[model samples]
Target: MTQPAFVAPGVVTAFCPKPTSHTGVVVMVAAKGDGVVVLDSGMAEPMPDALGPALELLGATTADVRAVLSTHGHRDHTGGSRALRDASGALTYFSADDEGLAGFAPDVPVTDGDVISSGDLRFEVVTTPGHTAGSVCFYEPTLKLLVAGDGVQGVGSARKLPVYYESGTRYRASLRKLLALEIDTLVVGHPLAWRGANTHVFTGAQCHELLEDSFAAAEAIRAAVAAVGPHPTPHRAALAVLATSPIFDHFDPGDPVEEDTEATLDSELRDLAGTAVR
Candidate 1:
């Protein structure tokens, strides 16, 4: 399918073939005046059919793409990097801390507090390194939007935390950083925007609360794992604790747990990384 011309100012244009059981692929298109900044190229191999169509929505051909900014080095987020760069001659930007994950060096090595601009739109680089060593969120103060890669998601109050982190503690700290910002819209990586309704702009206090909740969940999972003796069942045990946590309780009932049982846990672990009993 042909991609669409850009729609909505400061809106991220998402593209993916089929939504996965747990996540989805999204490509954020940041309008820089008449130019465009493409954040994340979805999936590496067997490119999703929606990619072309999604780009087309913005009247962007691969050649028109000027820059590719990555949230981190995950395959799903960086999968299309090579293709997009090769096709568009666009420079790719990433945190200097994530040079190894890019599978190539970044042209623009982003640092915390650095401001990136395309046109009238500018994003302040907020380093959030919990989900990955180099994970970062782009805050458009003018837009009041937080482009939080994998640092946050709306999975459920009780869903299992994402794996693939270089430092869980760092990730938690990053969450706190995100919360400190005045944000009403959270444009996440795997999911679309979380806004509207009763979702109020997050204050420093609320951000701190979310970080505390995340830390508590992590601690609960750690305690469960320690008690379970490095077995597969620890995941389920952790999930149970997470489900009961106050954070999870904030959401409505019937939220999905991607890996709810031992069988699914093993599968998810394999998919995320080689089997490890963490």
Candidate 2:
């Protein structure tokens, strides 16, 4: 069980099953007295009880959970939705593009700018398709919170898969789309974005602050795609992109975690150190 921490006016975010300083997967709950909302259910069989613990942290559960909003179709974020929905009887929602992938269809098909309000809480869906064809982030204007499910990945290591992203152009557009929102608490699906220490989530000013790095990562990838061209060699093209990457710590998620992200960066620098000498 991940420790739940208060993030914004009506939000608490936690990394479940196990806790890691920089892992991107997380569960978030946003609530107000009359109703509650589970942003994303963790990867579990029965789907963890989102309300009891969420309200407990707030010193408040009535049978008033209004909905479960999934940011994308990825199993880690949406796996527990059906179970939670079955248990709480709350309405479940996700992007329509993900219906084929997530298995269980949502009660409400969410689209860009679609608003979901429960009592005093309101979340507006922003379509961000790079992470997945149907990936999205929810913005609570009142709470100034953004539930970014893998939308803005931490740069150190990323999961390379088609479901995660297909078009760099669409991905960059998605990042710019999110930059327009007003946010104080940003709950990323994973904490791929770096901090001094491995930090899974960003709260208050740090949310907006860390986005600078996230945006730069997007731009860097865009550049890589351009450099790769129409007929690029897979391995050489990838290494070339990594070489010119602005985000220094990019790696594959399946890559060994024992290797500290910084150490990989340092090794790259050491390899490049002799260039000036030569």
Encode model 1's per-residue lDDT on 9-84: one tens digit a residue: 6454565432553434354444444456777766776453345655555565566677788888766677777777
Q: Which stretches of candidate 1 lie over 4 Å from their true place?
A: 1-8, 18-21, 24-27, 30-34, 46-49, 154-164, 192-236, 246-278
Root mean square deviation (Cα) for candidate 1 = 6.7
lDDT of 2 by residue, 105-166 (tens): 88999999899887777788999986668888998887788888878765543433111344
Q: How far is candidate 2 from the true structure (C-alpha RMSD, Å)?
A: 8.1
Task: Judge candidate 1 against the unseen true structure and give its global Cα lDDT, from 0 to 1.
Answer: 0.57
User: Which 10 residues in a row give candidate 2 its minimum summed lDDT?
Assistant: 156-165
lDDT of 2 at 184: 76
